[model samples]
Target: LRADIYPTLESPSATDWADRMALPVASIMWTPVASVTPDTDIRRVAQVLLDTRLPGLPVVDDNGLLTGFVSRTDILRAVANDPPLDVWG
Candidate 1:
């Protein structure tokens, strides 16, 4: 599978991430704590991505710190197997 194969994405701000927590998104977001973990295995992350029915996950570390972000693309890019970058600009 391609890394960057997200179905729908809406660019929003940091506050928006929280504002839309209960609101429905076009795609599922990784559970804040469960999805974000430093030691979290990418494969497991991918599984979470698949399981949660989301295109990607918000990367967080232990203690609920937002570290980085991860999508299928991020993982695939790590392995140099990413899908084509979306050109929305």
Candidate 2:
């Protein structure tokens, strides 16, 4: 939905907040949005993000409600924080 929201986010000239707010949510929202579960593998999550070309994805529960978000930066940070393996040892 980020792409859908992007067009309405900024304009060439100043925009009226009231006008933007009045627009129907359906008109601006994307359909069939993808999401992942809490138990989803990190590798699968990475693949989904790459395929969707999104900065992040929603983390949903079994009931299909959003619990949190997982982002590219979050994955990168996890990798960066891990101690490097002693391959030569």
Candidate 3:
């Protein structure tokens, strides 16, 4: 299960630990299915993250296969570099 859903499992609504362990992973997973291409500009990636309220997104290739994952930290690092990546650059 995703860490994002951890709090929900601790709430009163959730069953006890033993019962939760028996449940399926699919029920609590955060599967936004959002992704970006390797060459997609940083601006677009930031926009998608904001729209989905997700911490990160999967990076896919032209064949629709997972290549890597991009998180908000990655974007921040890019912008904070000595020569920050510009929207046009």
Best by lDDT: 3
Q: Write the per-residue lDDT of candidate 2 for residues 1-89, one digit (tens) a residue.
A: 43345555554233555665679988766578799999999879989989988899999999999999999997777666666545576
Q: Estimate each model's TM-score.
A: 0.48, 0.69, 0.69
Error of 3 at 64 (Å): 1.4
Clash-forming residue pairs, model 2? none
Report the error of model 1 at residue 44, Å: 0.2
Prediction 3 global C-alpha lDDT: 0.81
lDDT of each: 0.65, 0.79, 0.81
The true-versus-predicted C-alpha distance at residue 69 of model 1, in Å, is 0.7
Error of 2 at 1 (Å): 9.0
Q: Model 2: how large is the Cα RMSD against the reference?
A: 4.1
Off by over 4 Å in 1: 1-34, 81-89
Per-residue lDDT tens digits of candidate 1, residues 46-73?
8887887666776766666778778877
lDDT of 3 at 30: 57
User: What is the Cα-based TM-score of model 3?
Assistant: 0.69
